[model samples]
Target: MTIIRQRLNELRRRAFAGRTGEIELFRSMLGAGGVLFLHGPGGIGKSALLDVLADVAGTASADPIRIDGRDVPPVPGSLQARSGSGRTVLLLDTYELLAPIDDWVREEFLPALPADAVVVIAARRPPSSRWLADPAWRELVRVVALRNLAPHDGRAYLAG
Candidate 1:
């Protein structure tokens, strides 16, 4: 297996830690979803975690497309042309740069998403709106806040 897959497996072991509930959440999203958001402040492990997730998706034979917010396309329709059929995962890092939720949803976020793939948005915060605040989006959008690793966990992670 590739190093990414190995590292992702390790992350699954450490982060999920026998928690089927959490595993199922990710699994369900991979199978079918509305949207999954991993939001946290800078320097948080958000990017690292996203890397692991993308790795897993690749291992599962999914095509992972990574887009830096700085280079995002200007229009949403362009997304459909870019992402074809199959399991196409669209990941946007540093998504906070795309403000005004409506524009993002229409232009960059929505169109780029393939019908049969998982869409992961790693941002500092969710959109500030009533629709985003709704419980459905809240459930679909898993916000994993960054937390300090315990000394032991840190040491173990490094050793791994």
Candidate 2:
């Protein structure tokens, strides 16, 4: 079953449409030790982009560690352990679920990562004030607003 799912996901990823600019921005920041926060309404393709970004990380010779926020515990230790020290790309999806530990993730967990780690966050809403208010984060964080796909891209994705 897992093998089948992996194959299916690979096919879908190949057919994934649009967001070329977003993908490029993510690629530029890869291994740059910055936060790429992708926010939009539910089902807006943030998770899908992360999937592609994970593959991008692989091609760049970086190991990608993806953790869906819903599956993460509140403990920072657990996340640290799962991510490990070698991960160059850390993808966090469904980030709203991690609200309970948001501050810790921004303040503690992220700060502890290796200098070159790239963290991509997919959430339903824009980042909270804490993330934006911090002066130090201003230079390190890049927020990308995800809008709906264009008509042609939508058609291509659906037809694929």
State which candidate has the highest TM-score: 2
Cα lDDT tens digits for candidate 1, 9-124: 66665653222333355667777755666677777666666666666677777777776566665455444455546676777777776553446564455645555557777778
lDDT of 2 by residue, 43-93 (tens): 889988988998888889888999997887866776788875565789999
TM-score of each: 0.67, 0.92
After TM-score superposition, the amount by which residue 34's alpha carbon in candidate 1 deviates from its true location, in angstroms, is: 3.0
Quote model 1's TM-score: 0.67
Clashing pairs in 1: 76-107
Model 1 score (lDDT): 0.62
lDDT (Cα atoms) of all candidates against the true structure: 0.62, 0.87
The window of 10 residues in a row where model 1 has the poorest summed lDDT is 15-24
RMSD of each: 4.9, 2.0
Error of 2 at 111 (Å): 0.8
